[model samples]
Target: MLRIMLRHISLLILTLFILSFFSFSLAYLFPGDPLVNLTGIRDSSEQTYALLAQQYAMNDSLFSQYWHYVNNLFSGNWGLSFSSGLPLAEEISRSLAASVELSAYALIISFVIGLPLGFLSGLRHHKFIDYSLLSASVIGYSIPVFWAALIAILLFSVQLGWFPLSGRISLLYDIPYDTGFILIDILLSDVPDKEFAFQDALRHLVLPSVSIAIVTSTIVLRITRRSVVEVMNSEYIQAAYARGLSPRQVFVRHGIKNALIPILPLLVMQFTTLLTNAMIVETIFSWPGIGNGLIQAIYQRDFPAIRAGMLAVSALVLTFTITSDMVIQIFDPARRRPEDATS
Candidate 1:
C-alpha cells in the first residue's frame, strides 16, 4: 500500500514538473515577442523594452527563467499581472474562491438529483425508467455547456427574471470579502439585510450552477446506473435475495456500497472535468472565476496571466487525479492485492 502511494506521489511530482515546463515554454513556441503581449504595447523605445524584459526576467535564458518561475510558484509569489499590475497570487486567490464555490454547488446539485434517478434506472434495468434515464443522459451529454448556459440565462434570467444573468452577487450588497467565498462572507458579515444579500447571491449563483450541473450530472447518472446494474447481478446480491432480504433492503445494504467503489474514481475525474468546463461556463455567465480571467487574459494577450492560469488549472487537475488514485487504492481492497499492485 505504501509503495503504491509513493509511486503515485512520485508520478504526480514528475507530471507537475513537466506541466510547468510546457506552460513556461508556451511563450517561446508562439511567434513574436511575448513582451508585446504582456505589456500590451505595440510600440516602445529600446530602453523601455529592455526594462520590461528585465522586470519580468525575460532577459534570462529559457532554463533560468523556468527555474525562477517554478521557485516563485512554490514560494507563493506568482508575480504581478502585466495588464493590471496586481499581484497574481491575490487575483488567483479571489478567482479560485469563486470557482470553488461555483463548482461545489454544481457538484452537490449533480449528486443530489442524479444519484436517485440513476438508482431507479438501474433497479428497473431494461424497463421504462431505465430507458428514460438513458435517453436523458445522452441528450444532456450532447448539449454544449455554453449553449446550455445561454438557454438557462434566457429562460431563468431574462424571461422569468428568476435569477441574475451575470456576476456572483448583486451590486446592492457590500458583503465583506472575508474568505473570498461570497456565501460564507455573507453569513459572517454584519451587514444590514444579510438575508437579502444571501438570497441575491444565491439567485446569481443558480443559473450558472445549474448550467454546469445539468451537463455533469449526465455522467454521474450513466455511471451510477451502469455500476448499480452490474453490482445487482453479482453472486452476493443473488445470495442476499435468496436469504429473504427485500429488494430495497438488498439494494440499500449491499448494492450501493459495492457500486460506489467504481463510482468514486469516476466522480473524482468528473471534478476535474467540471473545473475545466468552468472556463466556458464562467465566461458565459460572467462569473468572476479563474476561467473568466483566463479568457480575458487571452483576449488582452497577457502572457503572464495566461501562463499562470493554464499552469494553475493543469496543476489542479493533475493533483486531483493523483489524490483520487491514492483514495481509490485505500478504499478498494481489491486494488490493494499483490497482483493489482504489480499490474
Candidate 2:
C-alpha cells in the first residue's frame, strides 16, 4: 500500500513538473516582447529592442529562463506584473480567497444537488424519476455556461430583481475588505452598520454560483448515475439481492459505495473544467474571483499575473486529482493487489 502511494505521489509530481514546464514555455514563446509591450513608447530599432531584452534577461537561453522561472517559483517569488506595478504574488494573494470561496460554494452546491438525484435515478431506472433526471442532466450539460449566466441575469436580476446584478456587495454598505472573502469579512468585523452585508454578499453570489453549479452538477449526476447502474448489475449486487437483502440495504451498503469509487476520478477532472467555465460566469456576473481577475490581467497584458493565475489553477486541479486518487485507493483496497483480490 505504501509503495503504491509513493508511486502515485511520484507520478503526480512528474505530471505537475511537465505541466509547469509547458506552461512556462508557452508564455516565453508568446508574440511580442514584454519589455517593449510595457514601455509602449519605445523605438522599434533592432539594437534598442535587443538591448532591452538583454537587460531583462529575455535574451538568455530558453533553458536558463525556464530554470530561473522554476527557481523563483520555488522561492515563493512570482515576480512583478509589468502593467500593474505590483507583485504577482500579492495580486493573486489578494484575489485568491474570493475565488476559493466561490469555487468551494459551487462544488458544494453541485454535489449536494447531484449526488442524491443521481442515486435515485440509477435506482429507479426506466421510471419517471429516472427519465426526468436524465433529461435535466442532458439539458444542463448542453447549455453554454455564458448563455445560462446571461439568462439568469435577465430573469433574476433584471425582470424580477430577486438578486443583485453585479459586484460582490452592495454600494451602500461600508463593509471592510477584511479578508477579501465578503461573507467572512462581514462576520468577523465588529462594524454594526455592515451587519447585513454578509447576506448581501451571499445574495450576489447566488446567480453566478447557480450558473456554474448547474453545469457542474449535471456532469457529476450523469457520471454517478452511470456508475451506480453499472455497479447494480454486477455479480456482487445480484448475490446480495438473491440473499434476500433489503433493496435499501443493498443500495446503500453495496451499490453506492462501489459506484462512487470510480466516480471519484471524474469528479477531480471536472474541477478544472468547472473553474474554466466559471471564468465566463464570473465576468458575466461581475464577480471578483480568479476568473474575472485572469480576464482583466490579459486585457492589461500583465504577464506575471497571467502566469501566476494559470499556475495557481493548475496546482488546484492537480491537488484535486491527487486527493481523489488517494481517496479511491482507501475505499477500494482491493486495487492495491488486484491479482490477489481477484483470486
Candidate 3:
C-alpha cells in the first residue's frame, strides 16, 4: 500500500514538472513580439517595449525565467497580468470560483439525471425505452456546446425572455464580488430583496449550466448504460436472478456497486471536461470565471495570466486523475490481492 502511494506521489510530481515546463514554454511560442501584442507599444511612440521586457524579466534566459516563474508560482507570487496590470494570482482567485461553481452545477446535473436514466435503459435492454435513451444520448453528444448555447440564448433569452442573455446576476443587483460565487455572495450580502437576487442568479445560471449538462450528461449516460448492462450480464447477476430475487433487489444488492467501478473514473474525467467546456460557455455567456479570463488572456497575449492559468488547470487535471485512480482502487477491494496487500 505504501509502495503504491509512493508511486502515485512520484508520478504526480513528475507530471507536474513536465506540465509546468510546457506551460512556461507557451509564452515564448508567440509568433512575434509578445510584448507588442500585449501592450500595443511598438518601435514608435512609447517605445517602453524594451523596458517592459526587463520589468517582466523577459530579458532572462528561458530556463532562468521558467525557474523564476516556478519559484514564484510555488511561493504564491503569480506575477502580474500583461493586460490589466493586475496580480495574476488575485485575478485567478476572483475568476476560479465562478468557473468552479458553474462546472459544479453542470456536473451535478449530468450525474443526478444521467445515472438513473442509464440504469433504467440498461435494465430495459432491448426495449423501446432503451433505444429511445440511446438515440437521445447520441444526439445530445453530437451537438456542439457553442451552438447549443447560442440556440438556448436565442430561444430562451431573446424570444421567450425566460432567462437572461448573459452574466451571472441581474444588472439591478450591484452586489460586490464578495466570494466570487454569485449566489453565495448574494446571500451573505446585507442587500435588500435577498430572495429576488437569489432567484435572478439561479435563473442566470440555468441556461448555460443546462446547455453544458446536456452535452456532458450524454457521455455519462452511455458509459453508465454499457457498464450496467455488462454487469447485469455477469454470472453473479444471473445467479442472483435464479435465486428468486426480484430484478430490483438483485441489481440493488449485487450489480449497482460493481457497475459503478467502470464509470467512476469516467465521471472524474468528465469533471475535467466540464471545466474545459465551461471555458467556452463562460466566454459565450459572459461568465465571470477563469475560463472567460483565460480566453481573454490568450487574445491579448497576457503571458503571465496565460501561463498561470495553464499551470493551475494542468495541476487540477493531474490531481483529479490521481484522485480517480485512488478512488477506483479503494472502491474495488477485489483488486487488492493478499500478496499486494502484504506488500
Candidate 4:
C-alpha cells in the first residue's frame, strides 16, 4: 500500500507539471494580447508595452516564465489578475467555495438517489424495475446539462416560483463572505433570521445542483447496476448461496463489498466530471463559482485569472484521481497481493 501510494503521488506531481505547462502555454498561444486587454488602449506606445511586459514578466523567455510561475505557485503567490489588479489566488478563493459547495450538493444527490435505484435494478435484472431504472438513467444521461438547468429555472423559478432564478443567496441577506460557502457563512453569521438566510441559499442551490446531479446520477446508476449484477453472477456468490446463507446475508457479505470496488473509482471520476460540468451549469444558472469566473476571465482576456483557474481545476481533478486510486488499492482485496501491487 505504501509503495502504491508513493507511486501514485509521484505520478500526480508529474501530471500537474505537464498540466501547468500546457495551461500556461495555451494562455499565451490564444489569440489576444493580454497587454492590450490590461491597458484597454489599443494604440499604446512600444515603450509602454515593453514596460508593462517587464513588470508582468511577459518579456521573459517561456521557460523562465514557467519557472517563475511554478515558484510563485509553491510560494502561494498566484500573481495579480490582469484586469482586476487583485491577487489571482484571492479571486479564486472567493469562487472556489461556491463551486465546491455546489459540487458537494450534486454528489450527495447523485449518491442518495442513484445507489439504491441501481442496486435494486441489478437485483431484479430483466424485471420491470430494472427496465424502468435503465430507461430513466438513459434519459437522464442524454439530457444536456444547460438545457436541463434552463427548463428547471423556467418551471421552478419563473412559473412555479419555488426556487430563486440565480445567484448563491438572496440579496436581502448581507452575509459577509467568511468561507465563501454561503451555507457555512450563514450558519457562522451573527445575523437575524439565520434560518431564513440558510434556506434562501439552499433554494438558490437546488436548481443548478439538480441539473448537475441528474447527469452524474445516471452514470452512477449505470455503473452500480452493471457492477452489482456481475458480482451476483460470480461463482463465489453462487457458493455463498449454496452454503445456506440467507439471500440478504450473502448480498451484505459478498455482493455489495465486491460490487463497490469498481464503483468507488468510477465515483471519483464522476466527481471530476461534476466539477467540469459545474462550469457550464454555473454559467447557465448565473451561479457565482470558479466556472463562472473563468468565463468572465476569458471574456475579459484576463490571462492570469484564466491560467490560475485552469491550474486550480486541473490540480483538483488530478488530486482526486490519485486519491481515489490509493483508496481503491486499500479496499479492493484483489489488488492487495504483492504480485498485483506493481500492476
Per-prediction TM-score to the true structure, in the order listed: 0.92, 0.82, 0.87, 0.89
Itemize residue pairs with steric clashes in candidate 2.
Answer: none
Total clashing residue pairs per candidate? 0, 0, 0, 0
| Candidate 1, position 186, lDDT | 95
Candidate 2: where is the Cα deviation over 4 Å?
37-61, 173-180, 231-265, 334-343
Which portions of model 3 miss their true places by more than 4 Å? 31-62, 176-179, 333-342
How many Å off is the CA of 306 in candidate 1? 0.9
Query: What tens-digit string does per-residue lDDT give for candidate 1 at 114-160?
Result: 88888889989999879988999999999999999989888887898
lDDT for each residue of candidate 3 in 9-48, tens digit (9 for 90 to 100)? 8888999999988876765575667555434456744447
Give stretches of model 4 more than 4 Å off: 32-51, 58-60, 333-343
Query: In order, what is each prediction's RMSD in angstroms?
Result: 2.3, 3.8, 3.1, 2.7
**What is the Cα-based TM-score of model 2?**
0.82
Model 3: pairs clashing at backbone N, Cα or C within 3 Å: none
lDDT scores of the candidates, listed in order: 0.85, 0.79, 0.84, 0.85
Q: Candidate 4 lDDT, tens digit per residue, 1-343?
A: 6777788889998898899888767655766785554344568788887887776577778888778667878888877786778888888888887898899889999999899888999999999999999999999999999999999999999999999889988789899889887899999999999999989888999999999999999988999999999999999999999999999999999999899877877786688888888989999888889999999988887767887898898788789888887778776756566755555
Best by TM-score: 1
